[model samples]
Target: MSADSTRGAPCANCGDYAPFNVGRAGPRSGKMLCDDCADDSVAYIVDCLDCEWSYTCEEPRYNWYHAKIRVQQEGNTHETEQRVFENESHETVWRNE
Candidate 1:
C-alpha cells in the first residue's frame, strides 16, 4: 500500500498512526493506535514501514492477572515479553526484558 494510503491513519496495536492496528483487549484484539504505542504494546508480530514502525497487539491486551502489556517482534515472529501486573506498582512482569 502507498504511504499516503494510510496517512493520518492510526495503528491497531500502538494507539497512534500508521497502516492499521490489531484491536483492544480480551479474546478479541482491539483497534489500531499509533506507531509509538505499537512499539510500547509488544506485538505478536511487527513490520516497519519507512522510518515508522507498525506492530500487532497480542490476542489479549492484558494477562491472567490483568495489567498492561508489551511484546516484541523479530522478522515474522514476535519476541514474547509477557509483562504481568504485580509488585507495588501493579505492573505486569514478563519473562523477557
Candidate 2:
C-alpha cells in the first residue's frame, strides 16, 4: 500500500509522526499507523499464487483456507494465505496457523 503523508499527525497506535500507511487489518484496521505498528498488527497476508498481488487481512473468523477460497471464487486463481508473526519483516518466512 502507498504511504500517506500524515502532515505531522502522530500515528494512532504509536504516537509517532513518522510516515504512515493505512492499516488494513486487525485492531488497527482503517486507522493510520506507523510502519512498525502496521506490520505488528497484521495477522495474515493473502497472496495470489498466479501473480505478484497480495493484501493483509485480520478478521478473527477468517483463516488461510477461507481466504484462499474467497480469493479463488472472486476469479483469481491459486491463492494462498500465510500467517503473520510478530517482528517479521518479510513474508518469505511462513508457518502454519
Candidate 3:
C-alpha cells in the first residue's frame, strides 16, 4: 500500500504526516492540521491592570509544546516589547518592572 493509504495524509498547514486512527478527531479527523499545528491554533494573553507588564501564551491544542511569550514593558513612556521563547522547562524570565 502507498504511504497515504497506510498513514492517512500530510497535514494541510505544516505538511506533517499523520497516521489514521479510529479515535482521532478535530484537525486530525479532517486531515487538516498536525499535532503541532493543532496545539498552536489559539493564543491567549494576560496583562497587568496597573503596568504595561503583559504576556501572551499560546494555548496548546492537543499536547504540551513549547510556546513563546511576547512581554511588553513601559519604561518612562518608552514602550518596549520582547519575544521570549519557552525553555525546555517551559519557563519564561522577565526583567523587574
Candidate 2 residues 1-97, lDDT tens each?
Answer: 8545554356666777644334432333335555555554224455544446555444333133454344334332222222233332323222223
TM-score of each: 0.22, 0.27, 0.29
Residues 14-97, model 1: lDDT tens digits: 444455323422122344444345335332534433223344445423331122233332322321221232222122223321
Please give the range of 10 consecutive residues that has the lowest summed lDDT in model 1: 82-91
Expressed as tens digits, the lDDT of each residue in 2-94 for candidate 3 is: 444355567665776755542442354334556556655544444544445556545454322222223322221222223233221222333
Which pairs clash in model 3? Answer: 39-61
Clashing pairs for model 2 are none
Assess candidate 1 and give its lDDT.
0.34
Q: Is candidate 2 or candidate 3 better by lDDT?
A: 3
In candidate 3, position 62 carries an lDDT of 39
Please, what is the whole-model Cα lDDT of each candidate in the order they appear?
0.34, 0.42, 0.42
Residue 55 of model 3: what lDDT?
Answer: 62
Clash number for each model: 29, 0, 1
Candidate with maximal TM-score:
3
